[model samples]
Target: MTAPDDLLRGVEATLFAATEPLRADEISRHLGGADVRPALAALTEHYAGRGIHLVERGGRWHFQTAPDLAHLLRREKEDVRRLSRAATEALAIIAYHEPVSRAEIEAIRGVQTAKGTLDVLMEAGWVRIAGRREVPGRPTIYSTTPAFLTHFGLSSRGDLPGIGELRAAGLLDPVDEAYAVLTGSGEDAADDGDEDGAGAD
Candidate 1:
């Protein structure tokens, strides 16, 4: 067994050179299968308030800029797309009820989801096709991706904000309000886009 001090240092070096976030087991494999959790905990504590802090998202460990100092490094911000109300709604649905089918999404939305809506989310790497649900036509199901966790800084789906939180954050809207107050969050009307046969695909 490597000495405690050496093990800690080795774990730090391995994570620092990693091209992407690594799982604890992956880190252990790199250290000749050494028990890496203790070292990881120590490193996590060591970097607690530093410029870069170790964080685990969706079972992967990586260092991200500390919350307080992140702005210092963002000299130029990336121009990212702001999700439409429909896209945001669909995302929340998938996050809460993952491995859900397109028909389920439409049913919950009370409107046939436009084909491009899920496409937009997939393009953003926040959603993915999880495979066909085992039934009738085997409709494609959707789920939030790990990148969704990373982008949102969530440790897991369990970390997703609750309804009250979303309402407080001003992210919740009339559609959500209607859905919550009524049936399983379904709206009262269909969309013009879907009515025009865009939902046919």
Candidate 2:
């Protein structure tokens, strides 16, 4: 039988070489189908007080800098581009009510969503054209990508903060009020545009 030490070593090695976080099943498959849950639990405890700790995000596990000590490794300068308010609202709407058409987005926002706003999200690799809605004109629907989950540290869409949580965080506003309409109906609406004009492939 492979000892716990050996299992721990395998898990550590696999994670260190991985480009992305891995779930326990993925780690197990890489380790020849060994049950790795015990090994993972032990490793998580072992790294509890370390500068680098084993952390889980979005149902995947990886190593991350200790939150308290992270500032020690920060660079003096970093270029940060802030998202426009329209882009932010659009992203939130897509995330919460995905596979949504531009018309639906406009309806929810109560304003015309600029093509450039969606363009920026696509360029960032966070959103994608899911498919055309099964409605008149078949308007293209937009959805959040896996990159969105990874970038936002969400395990899944369900992991997004609830309305109460958003309100607690002071993030709820008049725009968010429109979200109730999304939950109430399943209508697929059309928008004026072609695939090229949509800006996302």
Candidate 3:
């Protein structure tokens, strides 16, 4: 007979090692079981004292460092990608006014954004292709994902930092400041490339 504790531990280990969140069904399938919630609960309780904690959000499971321990991990705030001025402008426009098309983004920024810039954001699990706009060309529309909120520590896009926040943080340079706002650092950076979540990019 397979010990339930063993099963729980296995699930916990898998979850910890995962680069992105997983669904309970994904865990159960990996462990050859139909129901792993009990095992997951047991594991959550077992690791309740550890530095990390397992959590479920948006139907996905992830292990995050305990809240109290997070400060220890804080580095300079930064963006996942070191976006160019044009890219940053484009992203900001899309984020604030989402389900927008490339044309709209270009119109707002007054410059044509490179496809690669959007690709980079998509790869970062922040921006995602929502659907085609109902226009003559049916251009694809882009929007921020829930993961964007989670990564930015926001409950909704309405919580996105405003100009005041940027001014207060003294992150004025559009490029570096954008990264700083997103990643807590101010350097030419790149995406970690963990886009496994649903419609991640």
Candidate 4:
């Protein structure tokens, strides 16, 4: 029988060599039926204080730089591509109210959502087509992807900040005040307005 240390080494090597994150069952199978839970737990604890951390995201396990230490390894460069206001607003809407249709998004924003806005988010791998809503015309619904959570350093959608938190962080716009009122009461205001028609360049 392989010792505990040997088991940990095997799991470590497998994870290190993987191009993508691996599930625990996959790790167990790789070791020819070795029980990997304890080894994984041990490895997680062992790496807790290290520069790199073993973390599980979207049910897959991988190593990531320690949050505070990550700045040290980042290369400074100009970020030429930035999300447009429309895209940013759409993304926030999806993150907060997932599996929502484009029409629903527009209803919340009180403006017709541009196709390119969703396109840009899909191209970024942050949003994906969840499925069709079981309504008339069956419009496609959108939801945030695992990559979205990973990019934002969130473990799940529940980790997203609430309205109060956003306000405290000064991340909310004045227009968001109206949004807060709408969403707070679980009611959508009348869209007696024109489509904003904003698009990403």
Which structure among the candidates has the greatest TM-score? 1
lDDT of 1 by residue, 56-130 (tens): 899989989998987787658534665555676677788888989878988877777788888988999989999
Where in model 1 is the C-alpha error above 4 Å? 75-78, 163-200
Error of 2 at 190 (Å): 30
My TM-score estimates for the predictions, one after another, are 0.78, 0.71, 0.58, 0.77
Q: List the residue pairs that clash in candidate 1.
A: 179-185
Query: Which tens-of-lDDT digit does each residue in 115-193 have in candidate 4?
Result: 8879989998889999999988999999998777776677777776666876886766533543433233212432333
**Local distance difference test values of all predictions, in order:** 0.77, 0.74, 0.70, 0.77
Q: How big is the RMSD of model 1?
A: 6.0
Top model number, lDDT: 1
Candidate 2 on 80-131: residue-level lDDT in tens? Answer: 5345556666877898889898888888777778778788888888899999
Candidate 2: lDDT of 196?
Answer: 26
How well does candidate 4 score on lDDT at residue 110? 79
Report the lDDT of model 1 for residue 68: 95
Better of 1 and 4 by lDDT: 1
Give the worst 10-residue stretch by lDDT in candidate 3: 192-201
Instruction: Provide the global lDDT of candidate 1 against the true structure.
Output: 0.77
Between prediction 1 and prediction 2, the one with superior TM-score is 1
Per-residue lDDT tens digits for candidate 3, residues 1-201, read 178767877887778788787889988878776478887787778678999877665567787788789989987876345555545556667767888998887676555566777887788787899999997989999998767766665556666667787778776644345545664554434344322223322
Cα deviation at 59, candidate 2, in Å, is: 2.4
* Pairs of colliding residues, candidate 3: 76-184, 77-184, 77-185, 78-179, 78-183, 78-184, 78-185, 79-179, 79-183
